[model samples]
Target: MPPKSAHHALQLEHERERDATQGFEPKGTFGFIRYLEHGFPSSLVRWHYHDEYELHLTLESSGKVFVGDYIGQFAPGHLVLTGPRVPHNWVSIDTPEEGVELRDMVIQFAHAPLETLAGVIPEVKSILPLLHRALHGIEFFNISAQAHERFMRIRDSTGLPRFIEFLTLLGELARSSDYQLLSTIPMQSTDDDAALARISSAINFIVQNYASQFSMKELAQQLDMPERMFSRFFRSATGNSFTDFVNRLRVNKACELLMETERYVTNICYDAGFNNVANFNRRFLELKGMTPKAFRQQAQGRFGA
Candidate 1:
C-alpha cells in the first residue's frame, strides 16, 4: 500500500459559524457570527483551507501573504478576497503596527454551501473576469486607496446593515478590473487525512520558527520519522528541499521588511535569519529581482512609506 492512504479531518463546514457571522454572512439572513481581536501571531494559524471564502480588510501592519505559488507582501488598508482552499499565512510577528492599531475584519462566507450566489446575483455578471482571475489569487491594486473611502463607512456599520454594506463591496470586488492573480497552480489538497496532518504540522513548525536555527534531523525526529525518509517525502511533495523552502520563506519576509520599514539592510539581514551580510544581499537580489536597497527605495517611493 502507498503508506495506507490518509485523510483531512478539518471540515470547513464546522468552522463556518464563526466566519459567516459578523457581516460575512453565510446561508442568508440568519447565521452565527464570530469576531476576533488577534494580531501577527494569529496570522501564523496554519496552511489549511475550508470551503468558506475569506475577505480581509486590513487597516494596519505589513507582511508577506501566500497562496499556492503566489507570494506577495501586503501593507495596511489591503482588501483581499480569496476563494476556497487557498492555503495562506502572513509572516510578521516582530514589528509593531502603527496607525489604526492593526485592525482587520475577516469574514468567511459558507458560500460553499450556498454555492449559487453567482447564479442568483446577476449584478455579479461583471465579476466573472475577477472570479476567473482569482483562480490564481486576485489582488486589488492599492486596495487601501481604491476602497478606503467606503471602508471607513463599512467599519462603522454593524448588523444586517453591515451585511448589506459588505455585499455591496463584494459586488465592487466582482467588478474590479484593478486586480492581479499572484500565481496559477491551485494549492494541493488531498482528501487523505494522514497526508494533510503531516503537511500541516510541518508547515506550522516552519512558519513559526523559520527565522531560528534548526535541523532536519531535529524536525524529523519531532515528526517521529527517520530523517532521510522524511526529507525525501517533504521535498517531493513541495518541489524543493526543506532548507530551500525555509530560505524562500526567509527571503519573502525580507521583502516585506524592505517594502514596509525603514530598518537598515544589515539589521534586516540578521533579523531575516541570515548570519552573513554578503549572503543576505546576494540571496535577496537573486530572488527579489533587485538589490535590497533598490527594492526598498522603489517600494517606499511608490507607497510613500
Candidate 2:
C-alpha cells in the first residue's frame, strides 16, 4: 500500500492544482501598489501567479523560493522582485521555535501604472531598468539588510508616507548593483510568440509528469523534434539541463512533503519521484544544504511537535 505521506502529498497537490486552475487575482483598492504583511502557513502559501510586479521581503524563517523557472534557497531578510504574471512561491524550510507570526512583507503593483508614470515623471525612469530586469526575476542578495528596513517602514507607515517610502526603495534598488537575475531565460515577448508557446508546453508537461520517470527522448518525440535539437532549445530556454530541471522539481516536492506531513523520509523519497532513498538524500542535501531527516526535525520543532 502507498504510505500515508503519499496520500497527504496527493491532497496538497490537488489543492495546488485547484489554485492554479482558479487563478489568484490580487485586489488593490488604492489604485497603487498594495502592501501586505502575513505570517507563514497561510492560504497565500501556494504556487500562484498574478499580473502585477511583486516585491517580496522575507521577514523570518528560511526556505526554497520558486520564481519563474528559477529554484533557489532563501532566508530571513531575503528579498526578491518578480515581474508581472510570473509564477512564484516561497516554502519555508523550517518552522520557528516560537511560532512565526509574520513571515513576509509584500508589495504588488501593476506594470502599466509604473510604465505610465515613468513617462511623465523623469525621476521614475531611473528605476525602469530594474523593472525590466525583473522580467526574469531578481534576487537582491546583498541588499536584504537595507531592503528590510525600507520594507518595514513601508509596512508601518500610512498614506503618502508608505507610497514615498516604496518609491525610495525602488530607487535604491535601481542604484544597487549587487542583484542577480534568478531565471536563466527572460520571459518571451510578442516577437517570440512561437518560442514562448514551445517552452510553455514543455514546462506544463514537466509540471504534470514530474513524479514519474521519463526520458528527454520521449519529451522530444512528443514535441516532434529530434532529441539533440530539443535538448539545446530546452537548455537555452531554461538555463538548466533537462536532468537538472527534473531533479530540482523533485527536490522541491520532497521539501513540501517533509514540512507538511509526518511520513517517513523513505516514503517521501519515492513519492517525490526519486527512484531510491540514497539518490533522493543526495540531491536533497545538495539543494537544501541539509538532510531530509534534519529538515523534518527542524520543521517539527517549529510546531512544538
Task: Pick the lDDT winner.
Answer: 2
Q: Mind giving the per-residue lDDT tens digits that candidate 1 earns over 1-305?
A: 01212221222334443353333334544442222324444422344565556666666677667665556776676667666666655555436544233456565555432336557877655555555455456677655565665555555656776666666766777766677776445454556667666766675577667678778888888878899998997775565688777777788788778876779999998888888899888888777788999988898889876
Clashing pairs in 1: 6-192, 6-193, 6-194, 7-192, 7-193, 7-194, 8-193, 21-33
Tell me the tens digit of each residue's lDDT in model 2 across 42-127.
Answer: 66676556667889989888878877787778888888998876667888879965657888888777888778999999999999
Note the residue pairs that clash in candidate 2.
none
Worst 10 residues of 2 by lDDT: 6-15
**lDDT of each structure?**
0.62, 0.76
Off by over 4 Å in 1: 1-48, 59-76, 89-102, 106-126, 143-171, 174-177, 180-185, 226-232, 235-241, 257-267, 275-278, 303-305
Which parts of model 2 have CA positions greater than 4 angstroms off? 1-29, 96-99, 188-213, 217-244, 247-305
Q: Can you give the TM-score per candidate against the true fold?
A: 0.64, 0.61
Cα shift from native, residue 228, model 1 (Å): 5.4
Model 1: what TM-score?
0.64
